[model samples]
Target chain A: MFPKMDALGMAGAVPRAPQQERSRVTRARLLEATVECLVEQGWSGTTTTLVATRAGVSRGAQLHHYPTKAALVMAAVAHLADRRATEIRAEAQALPTGPDRLDRVVDMLAAAFTGPLFVAALEVWVAARTDAELRGALVPLEARVGREMHRLTAELLGADERRPGVREAVQATLDLLRGLGVANLLTDDSARRATLLAAWKQQLKGIVNS
Target chain B: MFPKMDALGMAGAVPRAPQQERSRVTRARLLEATVECLVEQGWSGTTTTLVATRAGVSRGAQLHHYPTKAALVMAAVAHLADRRATEIRAEAQALPTGPDRLDRVVDMLAAAFTGPLFVAALEVWVAARTDAELRGALVPLEARVGREMHRLTAELLGADERRPGVREAVQATLDLLRGLGVANLLTDDSARRATLLAAWKQQLKGIVNS
Candidate 1:
């Protein structure tokens, strides 16, 4: 059993080390479950109770950490995106550099967008379109994530933003890859996407190298 | 008052000309209203009763034509996309067909995706990711619309798909424009998007022209 909160009814009051570690594991599970629920059930179908059950944490514990569904979902969004950024960097480390570096980096970024995390993020993006409260939470988080991705892409390609068109070329690459991700959602658009990526990689070389 | 359906409970049973015209107008109103509702309320918040009220049609009439929510929404998705394609073609007619044709075409496509129709389609797309029935209705319709757009884009750019990379170049252009549309949904991404489009236009000219 988890330890009780202090008189202030706050979990942030320096709980014992063992309890703190347990709490971290529980929260991570909750966030991961929230993402899975979003991917499986979408924004409307996902609820706090359902997420709690899926996460294997008690409803009370879920509420204690994130009182509202918005808080829980937003936290998951942030967590998922942060994890994805780290994953992209880690994956990039294994890639080879040289003539094929740009192609490999583009493929890695495209793969990042085609997975479950992107699907979860997309559900939030569509839901945020109509919900102002959710939109408010999502906007800043996405901006930060997007900036990090753009910076990472520029670094990976070794392209200098100061060299005219380099910044836009990098951005175009992200946008094109994301669009391919969207296209892949309903159907297996892999064949068309492969062709497009090959073409983009070639044009990307000229822009970044020249 | 509107005419009643035939004994077969079908409106396509050779109704009177005036009644048929009225039905056409009513159907158009309903489809337009559905798109608006999807954009304003999202997929979960959109309902048959709400769409009927918004369209100024009786719920009975709405059901008589499209018995299920999925049917109504799918029709709207197809209708919205069709209208957008038509608008794009009509708008493109006024665009000059000279040196700046490719830039103008790219700009036009980007504008198409940033509008309410695209937002409504996006709402359905996310909803369809988890809803099998909705996905079933959407895939073919989107493919048809996508093909039309691609063909029109190729013609407008005077790009020959017979060329090795021209097809992928055009597809990439669409994907990039669409990704820009997604980026615009949550924030004002015009400045960054403008720069990216400029860079793409230049690269596109080489791929498509060569």
Candidate 2:
């Protein structure tokens, strides 16, 4: 990205827009690699060195992009949240209008909860609780993520705008999915997941019908 | 606990059953301290030195009881699980056989999910996922806890044991509650919790009636 002087040594300094684009691509690759490491190795093992190696970039290039580990990890999470928001938006747009919409929404939401992104985020969230610097950076980002998630969930559910608790219930749905995701970390337990999904579907059907 | 001697302290030279009582008390105190440490300061800040100080025991005495940090944390979690089992049994015994029972049970379960014990256990669970030594010790203990938890949840719900999916749905209730608990870690959103509770109560009522 930076003329490849660091690692990967491709060429010298390039032009403005193209250089920036390459930089963006490199940054995205590093962040994606960070998430992969978090999911596979958890917090303790997700080192900057590991991330650089995973990203297929030189250590110097990684350092040039992210000056610190906390910065790299935080940026990675924010990057992930943004990507998820875009995915949700696209999914919501393409979703068919029908009785089965809620089921599809739940499936999408469940996938969002139980995957590598969620695991990576969970690792950061837990670590940041005790780390003052990390917490300071994460608090605002998590708030933004929460708001977007709540809004998307509300949209997917077609929840009543006039209802006082509809939004809160949507938030609860996300919270419940998060809990199920946490449970899945230890074991896949599909029967438990299916039962939970059925119960969630039943309650949502009640809400929609009401 | 061995008499503060021998780092590899594996010998019958310690003492008899009389020693057992004192050792039990020391071990219990250490475990209690560990939970406190976990709740107050997550995994990273919880050190053996700090735990030994908090438990009002000598470092050597702590080492004598549990040789390693992994062992200490695992034992603390197992101890908490056992204590929770006892509490659940007592709660089950005192529970009334009436229409309000499910409501009361939900309240009790909610308290269980959002408390110091659950937080302590969650810290261990998250840490264990990354730590091989910790995970090896934790898996079996977590299985035992899961069994006890499932058993108690079934008792509280008065779920029919013969129904395959019903019991799993009950487990889902617990999982959802746990997710709510995790959300509460960042913000105490009582309104959302209440809405979820109401929804869950309605669903449970439907189940009971059916």
Candidate 3:
């Protein structure tokens, strides 16, 4: 049940502005709660009603923003992923311009994949496998997120894709980190991951450097 | 709703031997059907009744072998994964032991991950994220499967783990392939995969060849 917009609201008067702001706040709450639910309960367990309860909003208000579970979860993940991607880019700004910059960049990227946002996005990804509607929404969102990560990784590492193996090497790094993220989904693979990362950084330096 | 075994069958006589064989056959059918269901329907959409119907077995027969959905699907994936892992090892025997060995090994391992067995296992994997009981059953199964692949890869690459970066290099290869498989689930990523594989094989050669 949507809130009724009065005659002045219909005419776009300034007095109805607070209603618009309240609606934005409510929508943000729903999206944030959706990501939390996805991370905590997984896609199958997360429901619109539960999200509404978690967000402390009325079920009607939640439905007004996200009519279906698919739309709600997709939008929630996309919104959160964009924020996380931006955070990754922002975090890269402080990195040292030294020989270890690739190492730091790899560490930063690995941290992004192992965090709650990746977990939440992973839930949607698995669900989307059988749900074409979710897949339709997820594919483009993931492409944008993935491309942003790739470009940012290249920027932080200062690698020239014009070099022979540079592009694929960067991709392998992302793929490896993603795989490490998947490994961590089941258990803490940090010990083995540490060894692998150390080894990979040495190898990546060779390909990314010249 | 199990089939009633008569006194002759209860005695475990030679005449009742077909009962044992028939039970094995029925189990194979159910397991095969479960994998098919998982690949086609994903974890959430798959149900025991549906698997039974697909297998052309009575619900009683299916439940007799697997008392719960978790048990059924987990058993299905584990059984198939074992077979597939064996197949990967067997297929390796035909590979030429030459300069291209590493390339073929990576391709073989990547193929294993992109197949229906991996897809089915992936469904259980994601479902297990939310279901503790399923995770309890899956973690050990996956550990065993993962170790097998790792050992096989080490053998195929002839890498001595005593050397620095050798063990981690093998793992990185598996992780990279798994990540590539994840990328392929939603769409065809063969082109990018080919490129990444090319770059990684060259790197792998350096680590594996001592």
lDDT of 3 by residue, B5-83 (tens): 5421222334537888788768888999999998899888899999999989999999899989988987787778777
Q: What is the TM-score of chain B in candidate 2?
A: 0.87
**Model 2, residue pairs in steric clash:** none
> Residue A164 error for model 2, in Å?
6.6
Estimate TM-scores for all models.
Answer: 0.91, 0.84, 0.90
Q: Tens digits of per-residue lDDT for model 1 on A32-64?
A: 999999888988889999999999999999999
lDDT of 3 at A125: 82
Q: Pairs clashing in candidate 1?
A: none
- What lDDT score is found at residue B152 in candidate 3? 82
Report the lDDT tens digits of candidate 2 across residue range A92-203: 7798988988888888999889888999998998888667888889888888888888877887788874675465457667878999888877767667687778767776
> What iRMS does model 3 reach?
0.9
DockQ scores for all predicted structures: 0.70, 0.42, 0.60
State, as a TM-score between 0 and 1, how close model 2 is to the true structure.
0.84
Which parts of model 3 are misplaced by more than 4 Å? A1-20, B1-17
- True contact recovery of candidate 1: 0.82
Which pairs of residues collide in model 3?
A: none
